[model samples]
Target chain A: MDRRSFLRTSAVVAAGIAAIAAGLAPLRDLKNFESVEEFLQKHYKELTPEEMKQALERISREVERQYGLRPHVRDLKPMDGVEFAYALNLTRCIGCRKCVHACVAENNQSRNPEIQYIRVLKMPNGTLDMEKGDHNYATESVPEKGFFYMPVQCHQCHNPPCVKVCPVEATWQESDGITVIDYDWCIGCRYCEAACPYWARRFNFTEPSIPRDQVNPNMAYLGNRPRHQGVMEKCHFCIQRTREGKYPACLEVCPTGARKFGNVLDPNSEISQILKNKRVFVLKEEVGTLPRFFYYFDV
Target chain B: MIKNYFRFLLRCARIALVGDWRYHLWLGWLAVICLLGLNAWCKQLVHGLIITGMSDQVSWGVYIANFTFLVGVAAAAVMLVIPVYVYKNKELHDLVIFGELLAVSAIIMCLLFVTVDLGRPDRFWHMIPVIGKFNFPGSMLSWDVIVLNGYLILNLHICGYLLYTQYQGRAPSKWFYIPFVFVGIVWAVSIHTVTAFLYVGLGGRPFWNSAIVGPRFLASAFTAGPALIILALQIIRRTTDYHVTDRALLTLRSIVQVSMLVNVFLLLNEVFKEFYTGDLHASSARYLFLGLHGHHALVPWIWTAIAFNLISMTLLLLPLSRSLRWLDLACVLAIVGIWIEKGMGLVVPGFVPTPLGELVEYTPTLNETLICLGIWAFGLMCYTIFLRMSVPILQGKLSKANETPGEINRVCPAIQSRTATST
Candidate 1:
């Protein structure tokens, strides 16, 4: 080779080496290495049954190690011919916000940054306008004289914009009508967060900080599992509980018994009954999300 | 043949590496900025996006805004390519290469902005088409991934091939690059349109849902991209031995003038619709232009952008201020105005008074700003290196004639004949 070409080759090689060194320098952090297994984990749907069992065990071990609770984290699959749906009674809701805290506690959400899935908006009595609803309403007593309460959470739409916007299929709508995110798989671009009309999704900006004492031992692969930093999380209709034929913690904890959950495929279920009997409406109905979550007032 | 191609690349690399002290100094400064950005990014990686000013309310802040703006810049390269290639405008033929180089750098910056914005950038492999489950065809973002990467590759191929031929002192084979150039012209429109689709397809963000968004993006991109080329070419002429024709600059100026006029007209059309209708959908625009309730943080910014755009348009349209100084100022104004209009005004305001009607103002933190500046510095560095290598080839200073006589005669017969006839 000529001197010019040799010199050029040397310079290019040096620069390439420097760039590779610089790029890989960040990965040298031991903490990054600690999550190597997590990093290589397959997509939730792509996991084999054997791989899934191992994943669940790993998740359980991680939660146990982190929270000092031996959580029974299971990969709950959707049942045949069952589509989940939810309804909330506006007239019965007292703006107590017990459901909000219950969701946080049950979901094993971060305590310090306070990632709560439920938002209870206190609306002025005379208007159905959501814009006028106040989320930070701090009063001595709820059900204040001229006010009504509306608690909004994930609507779990059949045609979910959140599912469609994810560049990676990290988030998707399960066949059971619940939207789920595989925390390990999500790149946390938050496109889904931006796309959700109800602002239902929450991102773990930092490693979620729940007190060891406050951790719920029961967890599910798609629901209340301990999530790492840099992933998206949202309400999955309390998949752990609901999949086991129990109510979501929000419904169980509501003082007014305002929340209802059931399989929509079962015509006799409470959600179907509410849809039939009540003047029900979904939030941002014009957005055409076709939300499984319904809201209604008593006659 | 392969060995010869490799040698050609090495020679090009040699040209890229060899530079004056001033060039080294500029590159050093850029490297320092990039290092600072990398340091800040390391901190962000450790601490997570909580370090950013972004919250769940305004989930996307400055990084996304910059990404959106740079996509426009990258797509704007096609404006030059269209006239030169399609219209057969010889005056702009030499200048189109510079535009393509700018595109390469801008796209690199666009990709960097996106990477830094990702909460789990390490998991980026998940977006790969086959191995990873890329939600393509259905997701606008997936479509974006495809188009942006595709456009980058197309421009790289075109620029690399042309520059290599020029370096060999050979006339480029039309059959090899003509089809790609035509594809690039259409692909340029697609890149920006897909970016616009990324915003407009969101049924949630009312401000971005307008049908006019895609056209508005093109109008602004066409104006801003060419204006940047004009400024860069002027700087190149002043600092280097490169000869950028005045006619080329004038043609670019006319493109900017026409595109800026259309851009402003489209902005007005959007304004009229939003303000006249006075509906709930108009609230985001109201928040942007006039501020909603008591929060008006973005009002002054958007108005200033409007003023800059108007003044720049005026300068470009009038024949009185056609001097170099005035033209440079107009180009600067257009670039900054379009940056703010497309970025802070467009992306942020869409999330302000968010879909749920909560007004949470977003402002980029110092870390965010540094990261942005670092990305810009990186793009500038890439553009500088590209121009440094390509300009010498275009000027015929680093041609095959400089090589051994045997090598030149064997490898570049077309180049020898072209050079011999021209000389």
Candidate 2:
């Protein structure tokens, strides 16, 4: 490498290390290379929470040292007592893009102008017709022309086709049912992106387009902040927020109260009540996505 | 000794790459410069996919299509390599080594495109440290990574070893040849199979979930990739002392012609499966072919692809066109035309209308398109350079192999006389 190139590479490494450190970067385990073979028998989930934390600390420090970037190594322990669930209303939805915008803002998504999660489709209510739906219409009025609104997000499927297609174990469903991605671990193969039935995942084609002032400071290393270009990302049920007992920003901001999110296993929860009283259906249920989002018809 | 070797190599390289190579070397250098410039553009960091015209509705764009196309380009080499290496078609076997070099370069392009398509190119390494957070088994993703990278390594090892022996003016050892042949066949088929699985394996996307997708990819790869090789070899023959004969070129075209026939058959088979079954999944196919869902944008392009392929095959199958330069040009056009047809026309439009029924069109950003062109140019550049470097080695081996048949005969009489006198 030329001196100029070397300096540039060093600067990049340093910036990366700095970003990682700020992100609560994981610790590196490079010192125990000799034990790699013996360690192969151990699965990461078997590690105690404390052990995982320590491992993350090493990962953070090592990323700092190697690339001069402080890569955030968030606590990999499944959110304590976390359960996966979602709900949707077919009758009330107007196909307005409120949920999509809410996801971007609440998730601190990049405004630097790239594809983000959350899409609103205006579907004609009576016909088995998709082509009749116009995504490009700028009138922005909804629930018109005998049309129904369907909001699509990560289905949090029990049998996610996206998870099954990842070449690198970059993204997978947590035991609690939330699909998580190792942002740093993904090789950007896009296999998972292509296989996703929901079009739920988004790749950062570039650094996020968010302005510095608009950047959400309370970012989780794994969940939000500045995503690098190329790796795939999708909704993680906002574990960074929800795990601490906060409602997802999208749910909190819903104008129509169309979205209901909670633990499916909780019988006493409002979602459970809604499920019992209403005829709820999933989108493309025949395809067996088992979407966490359920639709209820209003009489 | 190392100094002496370097000095000798300098002398050889000067002889090999200078004078007549001036134009090619300059062109290659231009490609290198373009690649460097593209790196700088990407280095600025894409903020999001919004840089490209891909909206939430149209998530995939040119990079993906290129990846799909390049997989065929990468796998194409094996289609050419296998018949020659395994079947012992002496005519095609002579160019097998060159085909392998092309395969290696194509894989590099494929990987590069996949890298540029991600959201976090930096975090890409996280997948490496075994059992990262979301390790899902029974995923086509796991298969894609394994086959693509595995085939790449397989080609590298096979090509590298063969090139080394050829450089020493000797045939690769017989032991290596048989395994190499098997790997070539399996790897060629696997490359396309894994790529097709990326699409067809999806459940929600009714258009992609078909059993016939993999075979279609393989058949088309064989047709388009080898046709390109034959054209490239002809170019080489004209510009340099690289001697591809009429008979060898004819044999290559024959392979190209036969594969194109299969390629068309696969297309028909796919159409039949969807149109005949009249299943719900058929809707997406209908949208693409007949523009049922108001995505009529791709109709003309798709039909043009079909027409070009048919006409190209007609020209190829006829002896008059086969021997004619104009027919060869038409074949080249058909090959490229199919590449675009399969890559964009077939691949992306299948999923354009999201399941919830919203249509978004994908228009590639300048950065994305430039990067695609740069990588493609780089692949071609790599192949050209490899040919420049390795062809001499291959020719030297051919010279020796050519003489060896007579050489044994010349030695046999002398040995026989000596044995008789001793008796």
Candidate 3:
């Protein structure tokens, strides 16, 4: 070959090598072959029953390794004839933020960055204007004078904009009314966070910092199961506890019995009774998210 | 024929690789900045987006802002393509390729910005079709992903085929390229429209929900894109032997003047709607313009953008200031003004009052700023390399078959001799 052709061939070969090297550079951070498995894992819905079992077992093992707790991670499918719903009595709620803490403890939320699903807004009496509400109020007492408390969490909407805007369908409303996220499947574009009117979704900006002692051993594949950094997460109505005929931790921890939780499908359920008797309203009804969560006044 | 094509590419690569001291200096500076950015990105990957100035309150920041602005820049290429091909404007026909090149680079930057802004860029394959379920038709973001990628591919094809044919000293087939060029014009509008929809479709963010957002994006894009081209042409004329005619620059100026005027009018219309309506939804606008409840972090920045835009528009409106020096200054102003108008001024305020009505301020961290600068440098490098390669073919220096290897050295002696001296 002439000098020119040789040089041309070498240049082409060099560029090809560089391109391949650049492409494979990101794979170095994948750690080992196990991460390759994690990367190539199918979407939660697309997984076979065998794959699902393996995934749950893998996640359980991962949680045990990371958080020093043998988490009972299971893929909790929706129960037959049970559609979960939540209601909060504004009169009883005193802006104590007890439910927020309870949620963190139950759901294994990151403590350092402080990822709390619930946001308790303190607004003045006779104002439905959410803009007038203060989320960062630091008062010493419970429910300062004329102010009322509204603790906001994922409504698990029937027609969730969050689910609709998820570019990967990583998040979706379950058959049982609880909107769920396949944490492993999310690309973390934060479109769902933007779409949610209530700002109920939280993004894992960093690795979650659950204290070893505080790590909740009970976990759900669709709920809190030791989330990795760079994924979208939010309230899943404590799916780990809820599917097995128990109230969400937030409901259990309420001091004044302000929070009520049950199946809206059953007429005998507490949420149903509240919907029938109380003048209950979902926040941002105009947005038409059709939240399963409702708020009411005892009067 | 294939050997000839390979030879043509090698010649172009040689031209791209070799440059004078000034070019080396500029490239070295860009390389340093890129290295720094890569370092910062590594730290971000390790620590997560927590290193960013963005918070739960402000989920997006400078990276997304830059992405939004660059999408407008990329979309601006159609302005040249439409006038030249449809209206038979010969003055702009020579320069249309430059605009296309700009689109390619801008779209690349847009894609890069989006990639860096992602929380899990490693999981990007999750958005792919079939292998990963893309929520197409349903998600505006999915639509954006499709259009942006499609536009990039379309431009690459058009530019590649045209430039390749030029290098081969043959006429590009109209059947192959013309239909695609028309498709590109429509596709350009779709990219910016879809990007705007990414914001406007969010019913929660009232600031971006305005009907005027899509139009505003188009107006500002048309203004910024051509304004950038005018500046690029001036630099090319000064530094290289490329013959960018004054008439071409003047034509671009006219496009800029009209678009800037429309952009300003749209801004006024948006301002009137927000301030006059006096609703709770206007809270974000109030915070942007007049500041809300004493939190006025973005107030100065928005007003500065408005002032720069108006000043540039006023300059362009006058016939006397249409001289090269004044026109160049106006173009620079228009480019910066639209960048601020669209970038931080537009993206940040949508999340300022946030959906929950909190007033947490967000300023990009040093790491974010460096990364942004690095991306800009990388884009410039790409543009420079593309121009270096194409300009020779356009000049008919490298396309002649009889030209020997020794003749290639004589044709562009500065690069060829520099290579010899360095080695």
Highest DockQ: give the candidate number.
1
Error of 1 at B264 (Å): 0.3
lDDT of the candidates, in the order given: 0.88, 0.68, 0.87
Name every residue pair that clashes in candidate 3: none
Q: Score the docking of each candidate (DockQ).
A: 0.56, 0.30, 0.46
B363-409 per-residue lDDT for model 2 (tens digits): 56676666677777777767766676666666673332333333333
Which segments of candidate 2 are over 4 A away from where they belong? A1-82, A94-102, A112-117, A134-145, A187-189, A209-231, A255-257, B1-16, B19-33, B36-50, B129-137, B169-171, B275-287, B290-295, B324-327, B397-423
lDDT for predicted candidate 2 compared with the true structure: 0.68
Instruction: After superposing candidate 1 on the true structure, give the runs of residues whose Cα lies further than 4 Å from its correct spot.
Output: A1-34, B404-423
State which candidate, 2 or 3, has the greater TM-score. Answer: 3
| Ten-residue stretch with the least lDDT total in model 3 chain A | A25-34
Which 10-residue window of candidate 2 chain A scores lowest in summed lDDT? A25-34
Candidate closest to the true structure, highest lDDT:
1
Q: In each prediction, how many residue pairs overlap at the backbone (N, C-alpha, C within less than 3 A)?
A: 1, 55, 0
Full ranking by lDDT: 1, 3, 2
A148-247 per-residue lDDT for model 3 (tens digits): 9999989888889898888989998888988888877888788788788888989889888878999988878888788888888999999999999988
Q: Write one digit per residue (lDDT tens) for candidate 3, span B216-277.
A: 99999999999998999888888889898899889888999999999999999999999898
At residue A104, give the lDDT of candidate 2: 82
